[model samples]
Target: MSLPTTTKEYFWKELGSLANLSFRESKLPPLKSHEVLVKIHAVSLQYRDLVIGLGQYPANVRDQLVACSDMAGEVILAGKDAGSEWKPGDRVSANFCADHIAGETTLEIQQTAHGGPIHGVLTQYKSFRPHSLVRIPEHLSYEEASTLPCAALTAYNALMGPVPVKSGDTVLILGTGGVSIHGLQFALASGAKVIVTSSSDEKLKIATKLGAQHVINYNKTPEWQEKILEITGGRGVDHILDVVGALDQTLKAIRIGGWIHTIGFLNGTAADVSLGNLMKVCYIRGVNIGSVAQFKDMNRLLASHPEVTRPVVDKVFAFEETLQAYNYLQSQAHVGKVVIKVV
Candidate 1:
């Protein structure tokens, strides 16, 4: 195949609103020795992407930067040193942290995170170091695979990280967004009993169908932590995916020595932490997605359970409707991932 000379991409021409996003054609440079050029098929929206676009993310973003992080694509060209394992037509997803292949992520690794500090994958074609990409599961479509880089992997790491959720453990998932739903799926597949909370009873019904053992309407039951205790025979849950940043409530709902994976800040970032509540002896750990090695491990599990582990895509927008996709994500009406079909 002949290499293309130019590509179309969406960039944050200026920040503060989705309207600031501009689409333009630009030169597609030749790949370096260790680089692979991917034809992006789809990109998934995350809350952080919206935050960054609004100039609210606490990071140094470049001017006129390309938009999002999570993408699924076909490797259309690979430079000679890009590794023999990658080739044209390989379906792949880029890791959010380009250089954090394994082990603990450092400040340097975080700097390379896509969408904010660096140019992301919201282009028709993008170049990447081969090490930054992972072969996606064969059973997943480009839309489903696109959701894995951030949401699915964050859920996987929250459940299967330092302290893994095992069969028979009880887990509490906070909402019905992409990460929460993925956490529900992962926990259920691990044989853990899952309790999901949402403000909408309608979304709660959907969570029930998705295999949650119990559901809580937080709007109806503001002190849902007490209900969690009642559901768990007064013992509290073994793991809590604290997406809402409600530390006080999580501290109340956690079991003795339980794990609380602080994954999101939907409510707000500032939360009053009580040292007295710390006496519950629960472990509070913040999740920063996962490494390339962890992503490969998650894909193996997804491959093994192809029938059950598909990502739930709420809606898909065309390449030209990228702004609409961002607006829809901002609206937060979608239960799962909102995708952009770039191909």
Candidate 2:
């Protein structure tokens, strides 16, 4: 738990690329009264990290910002005030937006997001305030815990926050990415019927094994909405976790008064918001990554029910292969979260 004089870290040194990222040795800063130093063991890859690396994300990050948001590690050092709350060797996960500890997210809170508008935890060691870290569940390994901060938390917010999915209700999750897979798990745990859409029939089979009640191959069935309505006996699903953000299709898939939780834009970001389409649903909630309070709540659930709530890590790269991990995520071949092992 002793501090090192210098730590190795990766940074986004230029815009519009991830090809030439280089590691630099930096001296550790003195810990503040409210801070603890983390020896990051693992960091998970998120799509937003890709955009931030390209300098296309909206957050006003530093010129050479560290390039990731989700990380899990040991609390290696704790300052005076933090000592009571955190101790050396405690496993912890970093919050996505450090200042958004609880309550609703705001523009100011969004700017404090890690990996963008702030230095991230893709380093051997990083320091953070107690409020910005959550102790991970004992059952989860550092790699598994690393997957929660962004993808899992967003999925939890979509399913459990704002409008909770109820038993006997049908929930639709688009694609087999990290968030969508987690959504499928939460929906099934809530006793709701799950319908997952994927372009790959193989991935669809995997989704079925993960407890998705129905699977749609959107590539073969161009009009997946029709299939969804058919599956529900023309009633449509009660909740839709639309990670792809297929606007027209999302508008078509929900039933009257059903909730559509828009979590990501893997398909596309911009779409013409048709007023007619908007009127069809009761709510179209936009889900951010979620607050630290939500992350703690999720960890509690994961602790109690490890079978249903654990993270599904698709692949792990060595810390030196961080760039390749991002490339793999870009290929969209991963079924769940991709991680970088930094221990």
Candidate 3:
């Protein structure tokens, strides 16, 4: 198949609002050796995408940058020296940090993160280093697989990263957003008893249907940590995915020596860390998504449980409805992922 000479994409011409986003056709450059051209099939919205648009994200974005990070696409062409790893019609997703193939993330790796410091995969076509892309699971659609680049992988690293959650452990997920919901699924798949918290009982009900063993309505029960203790027979949970940045309460509900993977700060960044809470000997670590190796590992699990582990897509919008999709994500009404069908 012949590659297109130009591709349509959305760009953040200026930051501070979704209105700054503009669409236009961009010249598709020829692929270099070791690069593969992808025809992006879908793009998923992340909270960071909104943060970048609002100029609230703690990174420097380039002028007129392509918007968003997560995407699932097909390799439409491979450069001469790209090897046989990628070819026409190969389903793939790029790692969030393109350069960080494995091991610990560094300042250099952080700069390579898409949507902020670098151009993202929101375009109809883009060239990628073959090493940076991973073959997605056969069971997932482009929309479902698009969500994996960031949200799903973050949750996987939270649960299965250093000090992995295991069978018989108890995991407390803070909200029903993309990462938290994926955490719920991963925790359940690991045979761990899962508890999920949300301000909306309606969202909590959806969490229940998604296999959360215990659900907490934080609006009704402000001191939900105490309730977590009661539910866990006064032992507290083994691991906590602190998506809400509610450290004070999370520390209260964490088991002694438990792990709290600090994933997001939806509420705010400031947290009160008391000495009493510190004495619990619990470990609080920040998760910055995962590596290419880890992403591949997560895909292996997704492939194995194809029937049960599909991503929860809240809604899919057409490519022309990109602004509406961003608005929907900003409203925080969606349960899981908000996707855009680029095809």
lDDT (10s digit) by residue, model 1, range 168-225: 9999999999999899999988989999999999889989988898999999999999
lDDT of 3 by residue, 239-295 (tens): 999988898898989999999999765666565678878888999899999899999
lDDT at residue 10 of model 2 (Cα atoms): 93
The residue-by-residue lDDT of candidate 2 on 23-70, one tens digit each, is: 888988877778998899999999888877776676577778887999
lDDT scores of the candidates, listed in order: 0.91, 0.87, 0.91
Stretches off by above 4 angstroms in model 2 are 269-279
**Distance from true location, Cα of 309 in model 1, Å:** 1.6
After superposition, candidate 1 runs with Cα above 4 Å error = 269-276
Residue 320 C-alpha lDDT in model 3: 95
The lDDT ranking, best first, is 1, 3, 2
Q: Between which residue pairs do clashes occur in model 2?
A: none
In model 3, state the lDDT of residue 253. 94
The whole-model C-alpha lDDT of candidate 2 against the native structure comes to: 0.87
By TM-score: ranked, best first:
3, 1, 2
